[model samples]
Target: MPVSFLSAEQRSRYGVFNAVPDIAQLGAFFHLDADDRRRAMAANGARNRLGWSLQLGTARFLNCFLDDPEDVPAAVVDYVAEQLGLQAADLKGYGEKEARWAHQEQIRTGYGYTAFAGEQWFALACWLYKRAWTTNERPIVLFDLATHRLVEAKILLPGVTTLERLIAALRERVAARQHALMATAPSPNQAAVLENLVKVEEGRRVSRLDRLRKSPTDVSSTGLVKALDRHVELRGLGAAGWDLSAVPPGKIAALARFAHAARAQAVDELAGDRKLATLVAFAATMAPQSADEAIEVFDLAVGDLLRTSAFKATKERMRTLKDLDTAAIVLREVWLKIRSVAEIPDGGIRAALDEMDLAAIHAAADVIGDIAREPDEDFQEELLDRYATIRRFLPKLLKHLDFDAGAAETPGQGVRRGHEVLQALDFLKAIERRRTDIDPSEVPADLLSSAWHRRVFPKRGELAGTFNKSAYTVAAVERLRESLRRHEVFVPGLRKWGDPTAGLLKGAEWERARPRICDELNLSPEPGTDVERWAATLDFVPPARRRPVRRRRRPQRLGTPGQRRDRQGPPGAHRPGPPE
Candidate 1:
């Protein structure tokens, strides 16, 4: 509980004037009125009067009188003397006698100031304890607040070391209490689970906690699945459900930070209470955080799948371009030959058929038919190639994560009437439960875009009425990803992917604050008035008065064709020589 947190400079300057008082500080703290002047005048001689007045101003400004009452800035002395009509030099022989000590006692009693002892000391300690227990404020901030509190309460400020020690002690006490409260929060069975997190088991090099703390370096489908597994493992421990409501959020956050940064071995070496508290904090914090990370990983994985499919589709299109060009030429030649034959006599058709390369025309028709079977415009078919990869995590993602519409007209109806994405999720979840059979009418057609609709339901053949299950699932998951990004749908217990409007002012809160908010933003209380003002501003500018924008012209190239200029050598390297 030593005052080690404070720097030497801070401790030295405490309860003393480190610099000349500013104009405002002098006016606020050092200004003495008629009653102060009268009190100083009551002291018999000029030296006593001046000394008394300095002590009074020092107490008011510094909240504590210095050991040497005469020790103060010249500006303070001159400012006080100018008011009292006495010279600053009269303070020379002020504290030489016992009169100075007598004057301090009189000042304390007459001005309603109490010494920092007994009841005052205990009361200040209790206040510091309450502040430390409730908040995780920095020691320096608490120290400054304590100083201000002492000044306001008319209690003489204690020594810097004494105040710092009090704060350090109270903080330590609060931390111990918090640790104990969190340590006993879990049952014996749950405590064993938390303790096992730090202990290395047989056949494993690292502890469970160490393994859980590591994030996936790869962002593939496999990586996304692993992230979801980790999230499930953390949630299964039930650490988030622990009764830690009594502990302050700041305390939990501090412990979480320590646990995250410390090695498992270091945490294992801590005392029992500290170790348990650290583990509980780690579990609670990472539960929700892992959920967010899993979703983010899934998002990246889906984006990669779409990008890979699009790249493949582009490559396929490029490969078919040559075939398409050659086939078009062959067809055009045959068509012209047929047109010439049609104009000839009836017997000329036989001669034209015998002269034509019928095998070449047949081969071209076959190539055209094969290429036309799967059109290049259908990119969704490309995504279908990776449906197995999507299935690996999509089922788990749908199972573990719950989506919400964030707000609804009534409770329990949001999932039904919320965003179209939620409806699709419900449909997919039902398909997951039934696995084998799917009803085509149950498809959420509104959730499907035009591209998806064509892929999901073919126009002819066996697949015409029976929808493509994989295509539907992938479409739903992609739309879910998009809606999550747009904040149209939210995941419960997640802050990053949670409701975006949760922090906004709404309902009665917004109603109460509307007038002040409008006033601050320089708008009328009536929305119509503000809209009219904006309209007026827009109408004030005439098209004839509007200035046309001038564009900067590009400089012409001076170098010869196929001759490169070396612009990297220096500032003027690209410029030509004077004559050569």
Candidate 2:
């Protein structure tokens, strides 16, 4: 059965010369070498020789001989005839003779080419099946690769329709295998859940799948929370827990891409196995992706809060600038009046203050009290004001996403670095568990930066020995954000925000590839050698030989454009005077 998957253009061009061969193509495909020339010369006539040579070159070039052997590009005939030392007209009576059919068989047997059948056909099918199973390559790409493989193996190209059907059949087989593998992953109850994803529930306009497919539209606490909720819903499906390790990642990704683009109706229209597989793929792929996005949205939301706070602080400071100036003037006047007294009298500073405008001094004191909190004093206080915003999503983010401190440096020691951030995360998790009864003393003081210490643990106040809960939460979140950005702390399953060292070559793999890697990088196998080389490059220039860069001065513009003085000549020799 032939498949109609191939486009008309592809069908038209396959196994035939559709265009004139370029110089390179002509040289590569049609040029006869010494052995080819000897064989061509052995033919009885010019026509037989030209025809035989054409079959040989065409077999190598197109990997198939045309049915109407004479139906080829004029340039091809000319190029071949020229190489055979015969006129182009010599190919006219070529195929009319019985020798033409005999020459094809001769070329097949002589050149070690085999027809596409039996063992060769089965072998090709198996190879195509493996390729189709492992990759999500488009049909056309697989077709091209298959064509090349046949050519290399000296197997004659089959009919275009035959090959297309084979590809279509193999792809369908792979899809069925994938669908069967995934369909068996979920139990009957879980399968019911997958079906429910596509069906629109009561009071809802879109299906659950549609809602889950939609990404967060806004970078806000609300949006982050919503994204986290979707992630939770996906994880709740138990798709992550399913043993899809047997399925290829590419196949999973392809299915997910299809599911994301396809409408709920279209997905529901698929056969049971396919529909189940698509949903499972969508859920599995989207689980980690959503977690990564939620974290990203949280990061952006925090940034937005910081920016909004800083802008407000700036605006407030700007509004009070005039009053601050007035207060400074009033205080300066009072100071000068007191300074005139020289020494403290019986009334001390009261004598100077009595002489001054007491009313103005009182107003200045009020202004000082109002403007006492400087804008740049502590930005964390402004961030603390939005603690409610962070609170909305931080606990959920910490609860759902699993963070790690990457691999341990020493094997068996089990000590992961970035312990500060990791400990802070653990503390936050504990706080989330404790909720209202979180103990302040249990807070990781070592994890807190110096700036956060006072906020977390206040001295000489009623708040002492009891750290501010909001402040501690915000500070921990801020540190987490920074650590995540630096990859000191990473979410386990996320790709974007996941462990930085996950892709590194480690263990025996590193040892095997290290020599080749060092040679490629033009470095010695020893780390000390590379370090010394880098150090030498840095100090390549000696202090005495290194010259200071001379600064270029801008040329001064004199008078108007039409009246500028020319300063191009030597300093005093020929300076142009100003225009008259």
Tens-digit lDDT track of model 1 for 98-157: 898888888899998888998887898999999998888999999999999999988989
- Residue 82 lDDT, candidate 2, scale 0-100: 88
What is the lDDT for 87 in model 2? 94
- Cα deviation at 440, candidate 2, in Å, is 5.6
User: After superposition, which runs of candidate 1 have C-alpha atoms over 4 Å from their true positions?
Assistant: 1-4, 22-35, 74-89, 105-130, 152-155, 328-378, 407-418, 433-437, 504-580
**By TM-score, who's the top model here?**
2
Inter-residue clash pairs, candidate 1:
none
Error of 1 at 8 (Å): 3.1
What would the C-alpha RMSD of candidate 1 be, to one decimal place? 8.5
